[model samples]
Target: MLVTGVKIQGRADEAQWVTQFKVQYSNDGNSWTFVQHTNNQSDMIFDGNTDRSTISTNIFPAQVTAAYIRLVPTAWHIHISMRFEILGCKECKTPLGMKNRDIPATRIKVSSRGEYYIINSNDNTSTHHKGGSHARLDRFHYWVPDNDDINPWVQVYVGLGKIVSGIIIQGFKQHWTRHDFIKVQVNGSIFESINANLESTWTHDHPASHATLMFEKPVVTSVVRVEPNDCSETTRKLTNGNQIVILDCALRMELLGCGNIPEHGCVKPLGMETGDIQGTQIRVSYNHHQSNESRLNYRGYWGGSSPNINRWIMVYFGYVVNISGIVIQGYEVYWVELFVIEEMNNPTIGTQEYAANFDGYTPVTVLFEKLVHTTYIKVTPTACHNGYCGVRMEILGICDDNSNP
Candidate 1:
């Protein structure tokens, strides 16, 4: 589930109402990370109800994807006593752009890697056939290598930093094949083997039999490969008193995941330089310098009208977005030395920050510990060169919103 907020009700007795608390969330229920404060060092403290009946609701700084959530109380009216409920919308798993051409055909690679094939696709011993790009599910397309190419395999470049949870595999409609020998590889490591029966009992016009392979845990990888461990085939008799054999490894496939995996393969600049974002999308809190109104790009640098600690530049995406990092560039010699990034879910809530530091006009990329989903990203300069602060940046993330179904 994508956790967005939390609602807490104090105890019936006013004397025992909880006053302040912190929230921690985990995907595996074993390892945990908390919602941090603007300082980026401690857990964010949320205010509780003053009265026993009134419910205190708090929204997270950014949407968190987790299977388990825990609340820790820091302060209370008398003693810690409360009831609460986690809030968020259900997240559905969509195709990670494999079946559809969201993932380009160039990113899909095919080869004969194992020892089962006598004809190698790479050795120029025979004509090479593309397999991975043709492995689309239910498209009447199947990846069948050349004859005697027993070690057919497909590899997909899902991006350098992306999450994959599972995959769906199907066999050709005209053939009944067993795909139990196929296995899944993430970043060169064998995670699990596909043990599904790929037999198709349908006709050419009907849907073929398929299987879903879910992982024990979501794997973060740049590549995903599907290969077979052993050769398996079926035999048929011809009307001319002859015998024919068919390879059972021919199959089609699709990937399962969430986030902005479909739009771009990995983290890319989010339109500051490309003019995809308009001037209305950016704002600065105290631009006394009256620098260019549009300071989001290198054309101008955002500077505060007066020297103040509260100087901040913000980008309002107008909609929910998933971001992995930000690329910062300074103007000439006036540049920010230290800064903090804040993901805002609300005006009052989500004041938490992630700290970053860099030097010079050279562009520096600051990656968050994890992907953040929010509508607004605010950057505040903590320290600057010669007390003059300026900022020109591009967001590093996928272009599409993954929060919806």
Candidate 2:
């Protein structure tokens, strides 16, 4: 379908009309692309109905062809209520063949978990467990790992390559809000992170439910791993009268993708894990006495002199290239909670701010709105987690020989 525009009618109540909205299109309905204005290249916002019975219609600057279209309410008069009609011409019919379902327990694999917190078992028919370790909703809840596993992960294998758009993760039913930050890995390498800190406002009617994390780009892979970086823990008494502490708990998971891999499905990482980058090229404004600035070890990272503002780490890419994003990981116990990137590609562009990495292990990938072509870039840590400034990162995007002029 070629989606050309949208027609919306507000509710009978005049106070419940939507004032502004933005449209987004998706091929699989899981990953969405925003409709942009040709003039500004920004998300196109449509002026909505002001009264109850008025039908407001807004046309798109350019037609978008997709399987599904959604309207996001940007502003509302009092409450958001609307009846929408999609305007489009029936050209080539796009079938809704995407299958999104929970990955079976048999295909799930965890790094390590508690004795009663069974993960790999295929017994999901019953919601009740003998030890009362299962949630009322399902048996897949509460994957409590041992306290020794600082960073625990749950992996899913789909037999063959599938185009994965996202994953659904639910928190423990008995616990409050957990899983603030989680990293997604496709195949064997880190892909991205669920940057949004998800937490349910527990209630009888609205209990803790799953949060769907959509990727920036769909990945074609047979295996996908999810690791919870920062999950708060609580000591619980087991059925055997033993009290144990669970670390970085993940309750339930579901894969969100179906269909064969496309020809261009995956994006390759630029130079962090592949060793294409040298250590000596990295420069730091201030290095901690106990840390090395040039080491890329997972256990070790570049730490600032003190957990203070204005500390920075710069990387020289040898040659200019169109840099897109970055993946930053923390040291053993030191990590930066907030930082900004200064791309030397354009001096007038200044710095772009980003906040991530709730823990010291899982890498947080931050994407940029525009491509940065620069030979060197700097990152300044504005906020540190627990007053520890640590960082290790990899640059994303391809290096172009023609860009080195």
Candidate 3:
């Protein structure tokens, strides 16, 4: 769909100075209704500027029935907004309404999460490519040893924000030494600590450096810090000198989507599966390499077939707006399977499994999730009947700013 490019001048250019905005719409200009009322995250909107940020794209499959669109700035005290058309469409189909749900906005915050990021005074923006752990959502995000004597460190402070309850920090820990340690401290006071030597440790000692940090009961003060006591003994813990760290903050910030693979800074982790079938990737081919090729008909195996080792896996994100659909790139085979589980750790008889959607040429983005939840997800491809095939897939959906995951 094409839009005439909206330009919000004056205070709309900054969101901090703006609080709420009223959005209205019209199908035939004869009937108009209020559609959305949003409280901006920041009141940065300033005066005397023609800068407009693409706020949110709620309308999906843009072809849906609508005639005109407009936004009324709260700062302007003007309920009257601008007007725009539905591009080529000329008919109104549905009533004007807010497409998003009325759930309370999510919030997550943490202080002194001791995983992923390394906080040191050595930060030099000019020292680009200089590797170290980084923090996000008030927690550390990366622990990979991308630098000499690299260690994951982070310092966080969640100033007593209103309505804050607590914080949760989770991560994977690999034990390089028999006495591996993971600690948590809050308000300059040590709360709890764990180590490989601890009887409750569920993992065994591996050369890999896998560890998690959770500093609970933070003071909600204006300052905090955390770092490895000394990881030099875990020198062999470096898995390619890199360790991926993840933290879920539950107080100050919602889990925001780390946009497009950053061109610089740290590297991005590629999907466990995203490549040609078997050529430098897990291959997807027919196991029916028999003299009587007719015995390996693909149509006959529509119901089911031999289990191929080319297992399929995907990371789902819940609450993402504009993610209308997805596409997969693989051999144009119909043998797509989806295994949905209720929990990542456990599966039951109620687990639901369905076949995935495959385009005639490649696999379309499988609509395997309405939102990202580990409750359940799995994939199995159908028989190729012929040979290993090459593929590249793409997905298209509503592109907006509201990233809820």
- Winner by TM-score: 2
lDDT of 2 by residue, 1-405 (tens): 556567688897456889899999999989998989654799977878777776665656555667999999999877999988886545322211212233445555666655433222353322222211221123444565545667667666553334555655565555422444668776323334433323334332332565656555444454566776665656666675555444435455555654332212112365556566666667787763432343433456777547455678777877776565566777777787878788774543354457656556655555454345688877777777777777877766544332453
lDDT of 1: 0.62
Provide the TM-score for each candidate, comma-separated.
0.42, 0.46, 0.25
Q: RMSD in Å for candidate 1, one decimal? A: 12.6
The Cα local distance difference test for each model comes to 0.62, 0.58, 0.28
Tell me the lDDT of model 1 at 250: 64
RMSD of each candidate relative to the true structure: 12.6, 15.2, 22.6
> What would the C-alpha RMSD of candidate 3 be, to one decimal place?
22.6
lDDT of 3 by residue, 1-405 (tens): 111112232234343322234445567877865542112332222121122433322221111124566555665323323222122222212211111211111111122333343223353222222122222222233222222334343333322111111222223244222223333333212222321122223234332232232222111121232334334422221344433332321111111111121111111112223221122222223433221111111112212243555433323333333332233333345333332323343333244443332222223223222222232222333333233322232223332233333
Clashes of each: 2, 0, 49
For residues 1-405, what per-residue lDDT tens digits would candidate 1 score against the true structure? 756557688787455778888899898999998877523667788777686776565656445678899999988877789988786545525687878878888777777421122333344332334356667887665675544665567777665345566777777645523445567776322224433333335332432665666655445444677875454556655575445445556667887755433233325667776667777777788763442333434666777335566888777788777676676667766677677777764454243343332333444445554456778887777767788876777777654424332
